[model samples]
Target: MKRIPDEVLDHIVEICNDEAALVVLSCASKRLRSRVACRQEAWRKRFERQFLQSNDSEQKWLHQHMRAKRAATHLGDTTSILLFPQGSAQFDWFDAYCERRAVEYRWRHGKYAAHRLTNTANVRPRGVRLQSILCAFDYSPAGDVAVVSQWLIASPRQSAWFSEPLYWGDMDTEDVVVLSKRQSDEYLVIQAWNMLVDCYSLCVWHTAAPHRPPRTIITDKREIPDVSLRGSWLAHRIAHSADTGQYGAAFVYDLARGACYSDIQGNIHTCCSLNATTDRMRIVCVEYNKSTSSPVTIAYKLWQVAPDRAEPMQCQATGRKAMSLKQGDIKLQRIDDGKFILYSRETDDLDPISAPTISLVEVVDEASGVLLKEKWSLGIRVMDIRSIASHDLFSIQQTYDKWLLLSLIDGSEVRRVHFNCWICSGLYPPDDQWAKMIDDSMWWNPRDDPTLHIHEEASQELSPAAIVYGHDDAITVVDYTGCMHRSEHQQGVERLSIEIRNRRIAERKHLVAEDKRIAAKRKLLLPEGVRMRTEGAHLRDKSKRMREEGEHIFTESMRMRDEDSRVYDKGKRMFTESMQMRDEGRRLCDEGRRILDECEHLTAKLQEIRAQIRALDST
Candidate 1:
């Protein structure tokens, strides 16, 4: 392996897509280390391809160094969404890429510190410590605690001025209405409804100006419609109901400029989702055809939403007929120009025998009609798809138990969580260094590291930066923001993972050796020792027979005493206590058996010691 030329090895590492494998391969020799360092250009390209591309250009993450370069090109008007809003330093592209992998490793293993929403908030009470659970998980569900809909969003170590908890109380279905991705530090969007007035209000609460009243717009609807937030715009749609002659009007509200746009949507399904961006929005619903004569079909409809209008784009059927119950949601994303990806998880009665339940469909809305081009099965169910903070990776709650980080660009699974814990996305920490989005290419060994041993716990996704978990008594906030792009932490962690892997291998070998030693001990006890033990067991059989007879007599006597001695209840407590213990005759016989067993053990030990001595003398 060492004899390979440096030129060939450099290409080998360049082709090595796995981060863990690359890091391990780098340790193979000095030439490989130099080869990895030389391929910084390759790392930068891979990093930019994975981490830099978001749906809209506004959301595309830019590093500080890239910002400077773009600033020069744009005549100092350099503006783009920051990959890590909290991060200030300029990192090497290779360093950023590797650090991004380390951060994913933290997510794969569920490594974070969790304080309750209350504890992480401003109201730090004296007894709040009781609610806080501190540990790296083994993936066990924190005991079943009631789900808290209330939330207080603030950065860790916000100064005394921002220390007070921003009180956002419970919603019937409490999901935070995101303001601007950048303005998230200062303002938060919330929903406040007046049941009596039947008016729903979308309000923006300012943290710094807590004394001032919130700027709000009244959503003129009886019930809250399905709302989706992206950047500064909030788009919501009411489900189409035929009885009321409602065509399911969808509304897009620009929370930034106080402008509203509406369009009459045709029959938006109840269980559909609306994905929004600054420029455009996409909504999906189950397509139903009311024809008793027609065959049963399971199909869904997609609609492209403009600022002024909405149009149903296309309808694609899963080629499945559900005779029984089949219900789930869908997620939509526009990858590139004219290209879109749809992930749908609808139950089918014949799914287990047919194919995987979740469908990953890549389509293009072209004049040539290519909506169902490349569809693949994910082998897991999708609860929600979350963009990992720093990378182009997306986290999917696979089952009720498992969570996986998937490549957002290609929808390929990167790293899966160690424990089968179910985590719901609560908040996403900043995607600081998720620059070049791809999975680390290490051979996955679940029990390789103790830090990754997790139990099946339930948590939520807060942000790409942090994980919010609720399993037991309190809701916990698990922050993974530390490993976002810390250079000091990155190499050390990769090295530590290697160390842990080696240590686990050594421990397994030690266990195998111990098993062999025990096997050898059994072999030594096969012939003469077995005969002696058999004779000893034969002698002890008489003692056991005597004890059994005595126990039977005691049992019969106790039964007679209970039935007949009810009137004469003297020393009844003592007699009952005596029944719990062996009688004197049985106790004596048992003591003799114990002595004989000890004698056999001592004889065996003596023989082992003498054998060892004889072997030493021969040596």
Candidate 2:
């Protein structure tokens, strides 16, 4: 084949619709990969376009799925791309999207449920997963499905069946409801039958079929103990492997039959490896022995599940065995073609073990088994990995990918990752320095808004937390506990008073300079006599107005300063009180020590007296 020109190649790569095409081109030559990879924006645009190109029916199906999943996951705004109103007194505000206008939403807070109503009479309340009450929630790409597991309820009597396996969805136009029905007699019971429930079941509502009651497709309750939905396929442990003494299983589910099947009974972990493509389904399986101290190696088995086929035919394992590494927690990412990337972390040695070193391993097709490639390793420990933007990986700060890691870690450390994609380039407030620069930009007046005030008694103290950029340029400060900072967080508001005062002073100086410049220009423009007369009167009137305005500004500034000072004083007082409390505690400790010493001395004397009494008794 004639070597394609650089420009032509770039164009071809840019327009490539298929991810496989892009990957093949990238692997064709170093120059091609560089050129194609550099065009990230093109890829993003293409991906978005493709995503939106789905037919209305598909779109509706996807949207409904996403909505159902969002409700089932109860992930809140973190996982939701679309912002819906949250009607709780705690979360009443609406943070709008870029293209979408902000609409008023009504929030109804109930003891068991919180509902958010949009301005339109549509009563689609954000559904929450029951597991979100106790455990974390996981959602799929289309947002049509979710899985929640490892739930802990508050009831005194704890039972394994107490774990909730609930799903939420819009039952009708008027009401959004949870699928799992609770029994009236027992609080944490779901159906009187006690079955070992798999928390991660594919609960999808076929909204595509008009007038059809949503059908919940769960794994065959007999085969799989715990099943999780991975894209289109349901991943579950069908049965324990008799050969390896591990859970061997398949990503088996009968869409037509509404059942699950597995050929080889190898120990298969839950929904860790089902990557969904348009036509084919990819299943990843990792084999490990807990008894032996052997490194866990991941293997892949791809299959094409067509609507016509009653059973999904397992295709040959095209990819290589994942990089041979010591067994630890493994996270898989479908890269391209039959290739997969595994993010594995070494288990910590601590009692309540911390996260391990995160390493990325790539598995590609090889002749015999699979070609394993270790891409990179990071120094910092990763507790979790979440893909914030599709195709964009988001993780805490680590050694590798320095700048991106730094931003992510900083944002995550300060609990700000939910607000913005701080790791991505070209976003507002360029970096941490830029964030500080903006903080220096504006001055606030205490009298204008109590929130801006720095008064000791009047102003509340904001907690020592960092600001995270939200959608658009909006910033939200979240505390350590992951809750949004409230007004009371400004309890130490006084510390920032001086900075506010200085900012006001600087602003006033700039205004004064601008006014003087205007006056001087006016003087030069007018005739001599006219200039003299106009200058005197104009200057007097201008001075009067300027003075009045300046006075007003100064008064406002002073009020702000006073408020800031008060806030500062309050913080200082708090610090002082804390110190005093500590000192008092120390003094008491010292007194206690002295009393203990005296007691020791008394005990010694008592011992002598006892000895003397013993001698007298013996005589």
Best by TM-score: 1
C-alpha lDDT values of all predictions: 0.47, 0.39
Task: Estimate TM-scores for all models.
Answer: 0.45, 0.36
lDDT of 1 by residue, 60-87 (tens): 2232234333433334222222222234
Best-performing candidate as measured by lDDT:
1
Lowest-sum lDDT 10-residue window in model 1: 127-136
Off by over 4 Å in 1: 1-41, 49-91, 108-187, 196-198, 204-218, 240-245, 256-258, 270-278, 289-301, 305-360, 365-399, 402-461, 468-477, 483-619
TM-score of 2: 0.36
Superposed Cα deviation of residue 61, candidate 1 (Å):
8.8
Residue-pair clashes per candidate: 41, 33
Candidate 1's error at 145, in angstroms? 19
> Cα lDDT of model 2 overall?
0.39
